[model samples]
Target chain A: MVSMLALLITVPMLTAVIAAVCRGRFCRLLLLSGSILHLGLALYCFNTRIDGRWIGLTSYSEAILLVLTSGLYFAVCCYCCSWLKAEECSKKSLWILGICLPLFLATMTLVILSRNFGVMWVAIEATTLFSAPLILFHRSGRALEAMWKYLLICSVGIGLALLGTLFLAFAARMGGVELHDLRISEFLNIKESLNPGWFKVAFVLALAGYGTKMGLVPFHTWLPDAHSEAPGAVSALLSAGLLNCSFLGVIRFAALAPDKVGEFCTELLIILGVLSLATAAFFIIRQGDFKRMLAYSSIEHMGIASILFAVCGIEMTMIHLVAHSAIKMSLFLLAGNLLLACGTRQISRISGLFGVMPANAILFLAGVILICGVPPSPLFFTELVLLCQAPLWLALLMVLLLFMVFAGMMKNVLSMTMGKKCELEIHAAPAERLIWVPIAGLCAALAVGIVFGVNL
Target chain B: MNMAIDLVLTAFLGICLMLSASSRLVHCIRLVALQGILLGVLPLLMWNWSKACPGAEIWGAAFVNIMVKGVLLPILLIRAMRKAGVKRELEPLAGYSWSLLIVSVASALALWLSRSLTIPGVSVLAIPAAAVTVFTGLFIIVSRRKAITQSLGFLAFENGIALFGAAMHLEYGFFVELGILLDVLVLVFVMGIAVFQISREFEHIDADRLNLLTDTGEVK
Candidate 1:
């Protein structure tokens, strides 16, 4: 089973290498085959646990990650088919996508299976290394800057995570255990005996460190730059997939901490999460750049996840993670379609997308509604659960945050989809509808889960 | 003996700060190199007083730290600087004086915070030294305009962390040493590539100029 977990990581990574070296149309086929194989492997892990060793990779969480990543990876693959249609002189950006796509997926898999904290840190850092080049795939001045901010900020964040790992190592040291032995269960088993002060310090550092990657506010400065400037597929992975993996790292640490310390940690997460949501809400309301607006939405979703985790609302968190992944993937992929049609991501210049690219417009409309947590959406249910469990004050705060996101995001997204068409012509092919299939599927699944209470 | 080693590290860490505040990029790089050399010998200095019985392990760890963190990484960084053809700190996003002030404050906080928890493996000197190293690295990462200098800051940050861990008596010295070594080498090379890419695109490697992708949040 451990070997299977290892295979889950290696297969995509190795495939990425092969895909990077492969030429022409073969790159897309190779990437698709690799993603499909990954989805299958994830399903195998979902169905049967290897003696129930890993928590998130076992039973329900494994299924959630698999379904979410598969949906996300599929959207990315589809986007690659269109998004990377290079001009004769244009460098084959597909090779870069091929190399990073699997590596990105593999890193997320590693994060889920990582029982050892040290291994988890390595995986988180690996995500940065794999994705940095992808962010710069366009090789534009904007892409270069975004890549730099992404690398510098994330490296420092991960560096602090390393410090926290060392602190946790220190905590383990006083317990007279090997640093490798600092597993969640092992830490929890010895939680009370370990130094409370040191444990608190470790948890704070880990939260800030991993929180940076998760795109929580204050530490989230790198997020907008990276997300807005990267190719749509990379943006989708950053939003729908990568953030959750880092959240899992924090969750792993939180699970091990004692109740009191857990409260302290959650308090910090909740504060950061709420701040991130509020910050995104403000930015999204007035944000001119469509891609940058979506970047802010990513921050909001991350904040929502952090808040749920803080309340110890695990079911809500899982639903939100899955729902946000699906909805955000739909939104980013549609944004890509818009980019192709309009050749600009500036919201002020883009209007009446519904008329210009009707298929994308409809998908974007659905995605916007779903993101706003309207009725029958999975996020609506998850948000409901979060409100119920939250303290009265927090419930009020969440309502305000949700309303801000709804209003702000609705203003921009609605204007983009509903306003009068500009002079630009939409050159979308009939095959572009395939990209909408996953969005429709996710929306339908979410609707069924909401109404029928399908234990998804 | 531990105190003595701590004092030595503290002095080197001070040199690192002075170098960080220096406006000259080459001087900053050189100071980082000196600090790396000092970090290389830190484990040996700290372990000399330990009653814990050991032979080549401590020395071996020190040798690796010196060779990897001290010598190899600095040389690579210097080469990157030369290749990029950037000298002197360009107009930093954050001012030099403020960056220095923040570093000092973070160092004080690290020192004060160190006293709060009495973890067994950490020595008095190791905590402040590590804290100073981390703070200086952060300042460099945040304030420096050039990608290379920011990376140099990161190297110093790692040096602090490595020294802290060395003090902690993590048993697998060889593995930790190798991990840190590989981490620095790989990260530096990756960072070097990013600098080259930045220069190729922008004709300069200043991070502040790269903020072209802001959310259109100005409420017009």
Candidate 2:
């Protein structure tokens, strides 16, 4: 029997090729079936043990990333079905997403399964390549520009990651470790022998490189544009799947840091996280494009997650990712619904979403409440812990930033969802019933958040 | 052996400096290709080759390096350039003289930086040369106008990393090298398509000017 891990990686890639060849209906079928099957694989692999070299290990982070990726992908695929059904996408775009979506899934799964640093870097790079096309789904010049920035910036970032991995390997090699055994698991055991200077350099490069992918402050210029330009489902996948995958790389490298280097790494992440939050706070306020607003919020949430990972520990960080992924996916999908209903994505242009689409408006409102780290949401506790971890001044500052993000989001969400009835023409198909996928997602997020708060 | 390796690396550094100053996209593409071929051959000279068996991994990596970086990538970039009708790089953010001076400064800095952190086996100059190439490659990407040139810049970027990786003689380097080469191949291929679309849509591939999407959404 083939390794379930091998199947996990290859299955979506196979579907991608098939979907590209098949016509319209068949393509959608392939997407739906492929994702459903992939989701099953994710569930099946969740607890099952596997053994081998290089790709054998399944750490807590990898497992969570895999499940989140597969689950979010399945949700996005469900949304894509309804989304495509309602609005007639260009054949070119449908084909592009059809091929890229599965390829994206495959590469993401590959990234999760690889225990080797080199394999993970390659998989991450491949993910960037596959997902870049999805950003061009609309064929708009703006989308083109976004895709170009994404491709170029991410390529540079991944190249840096490669260099980091090489440096890490060099550090290990200096300890008389063989090059072929440059698995991260090996590095952990022999870290004492690794040169502190080179190890620090490796960690720094890995942070910056993977941090770029995760949309950290300095390297986050590509995130908002890529997120907004891509169709809603792609945005959700990028936010939920891609970012977490990059965080996995960071988490692994941070794991490799010894005592002194570890402090430097943590401090680095903490400072970057605060800067990212500041960036998000600055941009999220009154941002006109709803999609772009959501994109900025992603940066904000990632900032929170980064700080959590740096201070609170990996378990908390993982929970934050799950909660954020569930809530953010719901929000972006809802935003997609809004985009379909009101021809424009501009917040100012959209009014009385409550009157226009009642179901989505409520879900959108609920999503906003959830995302803003409302009292009951796990994020509230997460934020509280982050505050506790930071110095008094920085904590207060983070609180202010979080408040700004919440205020800005609420201002936009309220006006859009609860304002006086301003009738806007519904341009796309009525897929109001399709809200079930995100609804389930949000409810699950709520349950998890409640559970997380108790567990904490 | 050290002198020969340093000579190749110095040549690599020289090409990187020239690349920073070059304005013509075709010229840049060819310079990158030459750098690629040098990258392909450097591994051959540096790695120990026994008469009994020269090792397939070495030859395969070298062959893939030359073919992809030297031949495949340049052809893809050039064809994209011609198709996009992007000729000489026009009005770079930095002027030619300034770009040259900055690359030189970057080389000096890299030379200084690598001196403190030396790997015992690798050539001393190899690390600095790789650093200069990476710096110069990034410089071209940011400072240049055309998307094609940016793609060429990206290729050069990969070449620099490859130069360093090859010089290190990393164990399992062969597989990693092949994987990276394949990635660069697809990256350029996709870039060609993007450049074509941008040119067709806007009739120009000026990367900086391609920025229509902004956060302060002017209700378009």
Candidate 3:
């Protein structure tokens, strides 16, 4: 019971080391077995209670993120097996991918499970370090550029978060709280005792810091480039898994703010939320790269998630997070398929995905429909909740941006998915057989929407 | 003891100034290493040896901090530098004089700002120095063009944060400190590999020069 989270984090790390030394086929089998074991542990912890000094499932939010991360990793694992066989990478490169893939999972697990702010910051930075190598899977020049920006920008952002954590400690000392460290349970115990002035600065610095990793506006410069260049499975994990960890970081700090500053914290999130929505709205309009378009969609949904957390609270935000994960998982995986069958990332260069890979095209279209907050999806309900709770002008502005983004995305997606057949390179057979991965993702989103139906 | 901390910080702040003003990447790297050694030593000076302290353990951790920050890390960056082959930040977006001037003014503002933030029971002098060093690190990162120089900028940034933590006497315990150290080591190593590759892939490591991906005609 005490070591549940530790077991979960360590299993993947062990998988990574063994995979590095094993044969390629054994490595693929290890990834599959490893993720299943992780999913089982996550499910077990959800039903029972667990706690430790540095790691635990202490809240509803932590459990939700853990499940989402593990579920997404399991799905991405199947896709990765297919991805590996499909792409003809050298043995050394394959070993590198094998090691990075699970280590990335382990670090992300650390981020979600850490009960202390300092440990959380360290884990988040480690995620950046590990995932950067995953982006180098293709090793193309464009991929290199994207990986560099992703590493450098997110590191700088997490750096600010470290400073913010330090300030929070200083605030505790100034406010006369007798805490030994930056543990979450202890911080909540002395919540009212923290100095408000420094608390506010710490919160803002953290928001901006993790906000960079979350890909909120003004800090989202790395998202599109990285998402477009990274392989399909990696992008799926990135959008579905990594961004949520960053959001968890923000929400964890926000949870520590005193009651007096509670409203102030929400106001800051609302402002960044609306700003992110606006930035994504402006850019998602007429994006040329299909993958980049999907990347923008992630920013849009993350914006809406922040707003959901601010206006409707954590329960609604968790629902939106799960829904966004499902949809993005499908969208990115299907985008990878489209890239395979179409042989081009630009929307203008390819058409008639319906004519070639009809299953992937349909999944991609469903993902688009879900992400745009259409009926039958959880985002639809979450956005509606935010719109009703938010002030009048903010709601109106959100509606406008959502519509503009919808139009921009559908315009590009329609052109690609529904035209005459283009010349096909046809290197997509392995992925073709693994369509169940993304298909399961979409179904999971619908199921979640149904589950979230009356729970709130 | 306070005077010693202040003296180290003063020199640390001066290195940041020289870093901002210097155009040659090698010279800047040497300054970053010097700055790092000072930060490593600052923590040992700050550690409170209250009664019955684990003197050997505490001292050993401090020594590791000094060795890792002061020596090992600089050697890693220098090797990567030798591999990356460029030595000067030519035509940085912000010229050396303007950049140095901006850093100097920002340092003054940081000094003024630190006076108003009353952190009790610890030397406050390192606060302004850290703030200024952070500003200078950020300045060098943006102003300089070489990928290697960005590494130097990050070194300064990491050093500044470490210095601030020491100044405030904020201890995250030995395990967390070791973990953070390991993370930074991996990060710089990854960055070193990236710089080496960036040089090979682009045939030049000017970060700004690698701007092929843009949002133009993206989705307007």
Candidate 4:
């Protein structure tokens, strides 16, 4: 089991090195195989308990997240194979992608698997570094702009999170607890001894720091630009994989707060969640670019997940996270297909997508429906549970915000899909048949919505 | 020994003030390097005064911190500046006079904050130094126009945290400290590359000009 955990991280790092040095074709093969092995190892760890001295799976929730991250990574890896083949990328750019993508996966895996708060913080910061290049893969002026915003804003935010971690250590010391290392399990064991005042400060800072990474409101200014400018596969991973890892950072820190301070943390989450939802709704309603609209929707869903976690606990948050990952990944990937077909991300410029590319259009429509919490979608069940647990007014606000999002998304979908065909020629390569990838993703989301909806 | 630590801390605070009041990019980078050297020496000074022989791990962490923070990062930033052909910040968001005033206000607030937000078992000056450094770093990031200068602000912010860790006697193993150093190194390296790209594409690293992506307008 320990060996599996070690393999889970090292395989990607090794693959990344090889990809960086090797030619492009071999690099793609290496990435695909490494991701497949990672997914297999993640699945194997589900039933097996692996506890290392410093890094191990501490809870079922973490295990679930690890699996979710790996699953999304595997899917993205597969899609990248087709994406690379289709796009007329330079050899150097392809090599960079080959290197950075696996490195990004490795860092995220370390984030999920590490039990030490310090290690988790390092891994999260490393993810920022590794993923920045992916955002700049296109080398456009706009992509550079997006990459700069992502690197600087997320770095400053993560820097605050480092300060918060130190505060947590300081809080522990102030409470007369002697900790050998900054371990989450150790902190929780002595939670009663932690100074609540300092703990609250740490909580707020960590939330703001990691919350920025999670694309929560106030710090979410970087999200729309980065996601829209990045290639489709990268956007999918940022929304589906990276956000969850950062939220895990928040969850780990929030768990260390004392019961009284935990209430404060919950309130903070709810407030940020509502604000994020409203902010996303406002931008999403008037968003001109399809990819940027998806980015805002990511903020909205992350907000809902935070609110759900506060009200309904980890189980509901996990369910919503999984469902949202699948749905969002599919939407972004399909959006990628649309961009490929029409050579533009502008919603108004795109028309009669259904006639031009029926497979991508259907997938996009299904993703929209699932994302907005239509019946039988797992998000719908999560929303129902949230409404039941939350206060009346807050629940009503959530419903109204979600309705606004749904209407806005439907309007875009109808406009993009049902209008007369534009004169823009479809750049359909042999690799264009990979629309089935997102269709498979949609099926996976539907499966989770049904399976978890019933069991939970 | 206490007087020596106090002198170094005062010097650190003085550099923070200089950072805010200076507009020359080279001067700011040098100030950050000097600040990093002071941060590197802090733990050793504390260990010597307390007569506590920290294990090999502390020595290793101190060495890496000094090398990465004091020497390597500034070198990276300087090379990036040369490549981008940016010499100095022309129009800062806050003028030097305003920045100095804000820094003074921040220092006053930090002193008050240090008294109120006391943690047990840490040096009295730790919180104050951390607070002032953090505020100065944030101010630089917010006030500077050049992307390279903002990167320097991030380094200063990180250095402040390193000082806090030292002040609190928090020995977060050599591996974790090394990981932190490596993270900062990579972050600065990546930011340098990004700044290069921004300048190459736009012919300027002024962050204000990175306004192509907006909500209502059609994306270019």
Candidate 5:
């Protein structure tokens, strides 16, 4: 079991080194095989209970995150195989991608599996460094700007999180808890002894720090720019995989707070969640770019999941996370397809997608339906559970904000799909196999929704 | 020993204030390096190393912290600044005079806040210094126009956090400290590359000019 947990992190890191040194066709093959192996290991860990001394699945939340991360990586890797074929990037950039992508995955895996606050902080910070190049994959002026904002903002944010971790350590020391290391288990064992005042401060700072990475409101300034500017596969990972890893940091910190501080933490999460939703809704209504619109939707869904996390517990949040990742990954890949076909990201310029590229259009619309929580979608069930658990006023606001998001998304998606053909020639090849990636994602989302729905 | 720690922290706070008031990128980078050195020395002063020659773990952490934070990172920023061909921040969102005033006020507030929230097993002076440094770092990042300066601000912010960690006598594993140092080194390196690319493509690393990816309109 320990070896399995160790292999889960080492495989991608080892493959990243190999991919970085190797050149040409072998790089892509290495990435694909590494991702497949990662997926297999993730499945094995999921089926079996693997607990280790330093890192293991200590909670169901961690387990769910592991599975979601690996599943999305597999889907993105499969998509990248086809996407890389179409890419015209320089060999240097491809090499950077080959090296960074697996390293990015490795860091996230480490983040999920590690049981220590200090280790988790390092892994989360590493994610920022590894993924920065991926955002700059296009090497455009705009991409450069996005990468700058992402690196600076997230670094500062994560730096603050490090301070928060130190405060947690100090709080433990002040509480008379003898500890050898800053492990989560060590803190939890002596959680009652922790100074409540210091614990509150640590929790707030950690939330701000991880919340910035999670793309919650105010700290979410970096999200839209980085998401829109990055390549489609990278954006999918940012939304689907990276965001969840940061949220895991928040969850771990929240768990360590005392009862009173925990209430304060919940209130903070609720307020940030609502603010993020409202902010995303305002932007989604005015968003001109399709990819930027999806970015805002990510903020909205993360906001809703955060509210669920505070209100219901990890169970609902996990369900929302899995469902959102599946649907969002599919939507992002479909966006990539549209970009390839239309050659422009402007919603105003895109028209008659249904006629030009039927496969992407149908899948995109389906993704929208699922994301907006229309019916039978897992998000709908998750949101319903959220509404039931939330206070009346908060639930009303949530429903209202969700309605605005739904309407905004439908307006953009409908106009793009329903209008007369635009001027650009459709270059979308019949990548029927590529279309299956999102199909598989959608099916998985539906399966989780149905299974969870029945259990509920 | 207490007096020595106090002196180091006082100098750290002075540098934080200077950072906010300075407009030159080179000066800011140097100030950050100085702060990093002080932070590296802090653990040695705080811990009771006199009882025994400190283990390789403690000495190694101090060495890496000084090397990476003090020496390596600032050099990276200096090279980036040289390449970007910018020196002073011509225009800042918050003027240097006001930034100075803000930092002064923030330092006072930090001292007061630290006094109010006392945690056992933590250095009193270190807390206020850390708070002031953090505020100034954030102020620099927010007010500065040059991309390189912003990165420098982030470095200062990180240095402040490191000081706080050291002040608390929190004995993180050597590997964790080394991991943090490497992460910061990589962060600065990446930011340097980005600064160069931004200057090359847009002909300036002024963050104000990076208005291409706005929500107000479509690029196409």
Candidate 6:
């Protein structure tokens, strides 16, 4: 019980190490085994409860959702086995990823379990480091650029967070609680004792800093570039897993700030969220590159997730997070398959995916339905709940952005799926059918979520 | 009271500014070395002049600072400079004279700002030096074009942070300090890779050229 979260974090990390040492075909088998183990542990973690003096992990529902999300992860891992047949990427690169992937998972788990602000900051920074190699996995010109941008921007943003941490320390000292005796509970206990002025600054900095990682507008400049360039498996982990963990960091601070300050901050988040959606819609409509379009879509969903957290209740935010994960992962993996079959990432260059790879084509269409928040999809219900809870003005704006994004994504996905058959034929992987299983399962989960039917 | 040592230590602030403002690469490197040496001497002077208790840990910290900041880091930096073969800061975004003027103003502002803040139980004199060190580090990072200089700027930034930490009398315990040290080492190694990669790719290490990879979605 004491080590449940630790186990969840460590298992994948350890598996990554072993997988790295095992080369070629053995690596895929190792990854497959690791993913299954990870999924099971995530389920067990959800069922088990652990309490410590400063931390607790008794949220069974979140754990279950987290486990299901691991299904998408495992599926991507399977796809990666064949997708990354490039001989240039060495065994050492895989080793680094193997080590870093688990470390990344462990850090995310740490972020989830940590009730302390300082400890959580460290965990978040650790995530940044672990995810760096993952982003730079391909080591191409574009990948290098993306990794550099991710590092420099995140380091600068996280540096500001460090400044905020210092401010909190000062606030504690001001309240007659010296820095040495500081803890999360101390601040909560003496919430009134903290200098509200410094507290406000700290909260704002933390929000903007961590929100940068969450891919909110303005701080989201690196998102499309990073996501598009990274491998599909990495992209899925990023969109479905990492961003959720970052939001948790922001929510931690939002949970701390009192009334008007919290409201004001949440309002800022909502505006950024809306702007992110609007921005994604604008770009996705005209985006030539399919991967880039998917990248923008992820940003739009992140924005929606942020706004939902800001406006709606926790249940709405939590449900949306899970829905977004399933749909987004399926969407990205399907896109990866298309890229594999077409031999190009250009949207206009290739068409009639349905004829070439019918399974992926259908999966892509369903993913589009799910992402657009169409009925019977969880995102549709979550979007509805968010609109219901938000002010009418904000709701209208959100709905407009939602429609624009939906239209943009629909146009892209439809044209790519059902357009005229290519004059030239492209060979696709025989194993491509495996990608459908995860997509179908995710769609089923989405169906259940939309109905709010599951008692678990 | 070691007032002379205090004055010399504070003079390192001006030297850091001059380094940031300089167009000549070798000269900037020298200035950085000087600043590092000046920062290394700081703990000793503080120990000598401090009316309060000076423990063995403080002395140990001073020795480590001197060794790492004063002698070792600069030597590593010089080796990197020779390896990179970047002689002058070619195509600096901010001109040397303007950079110098801005650094002067920043130093003055930092002094004024530090004086304004009422940090209880701190020597008011120490705060200005710390603040200036911080701003100078910022100036170096912002003004310089070369990755190596920017790295030196980052080191100076840490110096400023260390100085501020000292002024605030905040103890981060040994583990946190060790973690910080490890992070800095990794930072240097990664930055070295960045420098080597930049040089290999473009045949020059100007950060302005590195801006070729911006998010404008334009042709390279």
Which pairs clash in the backbone of model 5?
A: none
For each candidate, report what fraction of the true interface contacts it reproduces: 0.44, 0.65, 0.59, 0.74, 0.84, 0.03
lDDT tens digits, residue span A266-345, model 2: 89999999999999998889598889988999999889899899888998898888889999999998888888778788
Q: What is the C-alpha lDDT of each candidate?
A: 0.74, 0.85, 0.86, 0.88, 0.87, 0.69
What does candidate 2 score in Cα RMSD to the true structure?
1.8
TM for every model, in the order presented, reads 0.90, 0.96, 0.97, 0.98, 0.97, 0.86
TM-score of 3: 0.97
How close to the true structure is residue A423 of candidate 1, measured as C-alpha lDDT? 67
Which regions in candidate 3 have their CA more than 4 angstroms from the true location?
A23-25, A423-431, A454-456, B47-54, B217-220
Ranked by DockQ, the better of candidates 1 and 4 is 4
Q: Is model 4 an incorrect, acceptable, medium or high docking prediction?
A: medium
- Using Cα atoms, each model's DockQ against the true complex is 0.42, 0.69, 0.57, 0.79, 0.79, 0.27
lDDT of 2: 0.85
Model 6: residues with Cα > 4 Å off, grouped in runs? A16-26, A47-73, A85-89, A179-182, A423-425, A437-441, A444-448, A451-456, B1-12, B23-87, B125-144, B147-166, B170-174, B210-220
Candidate 1 chain A, poorest ten consecutive residues by summed lDDT: A50-59
Local accuracy of candidate 3 as per-residue lDDT tens digits, B89-192: 88999998898899889888888888876656666677889888888888778878888888789879988988888777887877788888899889999999
lDDT-best of 1 and 3: 3
DockQ of 3: 0.57
Candidate 1 ranges beyond 4 A from true positions? A23-25, A50-59, A86-89, A172-180, A430-434, A437-441, A444-448, A451-456, B1-4, B21-24, B37-40, B44-67, B90-122, B170-181, B217-220
State residue A367's C-alpha deviation in candidate 2, in Å. Answer: 0.3
Report the Cα lDDT for residue B217, model 4: 75
For DockQ, candidate 2 versus 5, the one ahead is 5
| Model 1 residue pairs with clashes | A287-B216, A288-B216
lDDT ranking, high to low: 4, 5, 3, 2, 1, 6
What are the RMSDs of all candidates, in order?
A: 3.5, 1.8, 1.9, 1.4, 1.7, 4.0
| Clashes in predicted model 6 | 1
Candidate with more favorable, higher lDDT: 2 or 4 = 4
Count residue pairs with overlapping backbones in model 3: 8
